[model samples]
Target: MKIGVLALQGAVAEHIRMLGLAGAEGVVIKRTEQLEELDGLIIPGGESTTIGKLMRTYGFIEAIREFSARRKPVFGTCAGMILVAKELSGQEEAHLGLMDIRVARNAFGRQRESFETDLAVKGMENTVRAVFIRAPLIESVGGNVDVLSVYQDQIVAARQEHLLAASFHPELTDDYGFHSYFLDMVRQYR
Candidate 1:
């Protein structure tokens, strides 16, 4: 299976490497036209506002909405989770708004507060290592959204149909469980 990583900004190479471990071909998607050729997409962790602005500048916002409307899987990590949320705490606008969730940006404090931990993600046999770097917190979820995992009582991982979101960077760790789970989502959609 081929998966495209939104290469607008963030840890593009790290995500690609994780996808490789998950047994999928990971392609960097720099243009909206590239969205048509993927089974799934990964929006990696980065600066949320900057990523949103760049996506808008490059005309990727609508293109991605159309892509997700096709029922293909879309996985968002950290800043990506913020982008996929329908609403962001203390903010008026949302980026993609593909998932039915509300997020709080930088909820885990600043960059120096970033840390790592293991999480028990649903449908996985083992705990997945998670890296939080200025990650956003999923403050609330819609009825359709399934809570996957939580860290310190905070909603961190969730899935809404074909969309999967995580407040931590799974790609930063060596474990490929999250990526594999996402591939399974793509397979089911296909």
Candidate 2:
């Protein structure tokens, strides 16, 4: 399986490494044209506003929407989760607006307040280590969305069909379980 990590910004190499450990060929994707040959794409953690701007400027906004429209798997981590949500708490618009979720930007507070924890993800038997850095919170999810994992009674991970979202940076940990879970999604839809 060929999984591409959005290389506009943020832990691009880390995500690629995770994907490799998950048994998939990882590709660094900068151009929107790279979406074609990928079985799935991971939008890594970064500043949400900047990622939104870059996606628009690079023509990925529509390209990605189209890609998801075809049932292609998309995984969004941290700020990437904000980009994929349908609604932003105080904002009037969304970046990708692909997932049926409402998100709170920087809900975990500032960078200084960043923390790590083990979460009971829905499918996995073992707890997954999650690192939260100025992460977004999935305040609510529509009927189509499934709450995958929660931390302190708050939603931190979710999935809506082929779209997987995480409020924490899964790439920051040594565990490849989350990435493998995403690869399973890709395999199902591939």
Candidate 3:
């Protein structure tokens, strides 16, 4: 499967490496047309507002929104998670509002406050090491969304239909299980 990593900012190369290590062709998505060739897509962690703005500048926001509406699989991590939330309590006007979840940006504090933890994700056979950096905490989730993982009593990862949002960066870890699992979702949909 061909997986595209949003290259506007963040850990794009890391995700590409992870996808390549998973035995899939990975592409760094820059132009809007790149979205068409993707079987799946991963939105990497970075400044949410900047990435969102760049997506708009490059016209990728509309493309991604349209693709996602068609049931395409999209996984977002960290600030990417913030971009995909349906609502952000304090910054409603800034969020992309893709997934049906309410998020609180910088809920875990600043970069100096970043941390790592083991997440007990449902269906993940082993404990996944999650890297949280300026993470957004899931405040609430709509009924259709499944709570996948949690950290310190806050919802860190969730899935609402084809959209998967995680407040932590799984690509930073050595494990590729999460990436593989996401690809499996793409395979199921494709």
The number of residue pairs in model 1 that clash at the backbone is: 0
Candidate 3, pairs of clashing residues: none
Model 3 lDDT tens row, 31-126: 878888989889999998889889888888789898798888999999888888888877736455789999898999998999988888898898
Model 2, runs deviating above 4 Å: none
Write model 2 residue lDDT over 63-87, tens digit each, in one string. Answer: 9999999999999999999999999
For model 3, what is the alpha-carbon lDDT of residue 13? 90
C-alpha lDDT of residue 157 in model 1: 97
Q: Tell how far residue 4 is off in model 1, in angstroms.
A: 0.3
Worst lDDT run of 10 residues, candidate 2, spans: 15-24
Candidate 3: count of backbone clashes, pairs at least 3 residues apart or interchain: 0
Score residue 1 of candidate 2 by CA lDDT: 95
Q: TM-score: which is higher, 2 or 3? A: 2
Give me the displacement of residue 35 in model 2, in angstroms: 0.6
lDDT of 3 at 72: 88
State the TM-score for model 3: 0.97
Report the C-alpha lDDT of model 1 over 1-190, residue by residue, as the tens digit.
9999999899999999999998999999999999999999999999988999999999999999999999989999999999999999998989998999999999999999999999998899999999999889999999999999999999999999999999999999999999999999999999
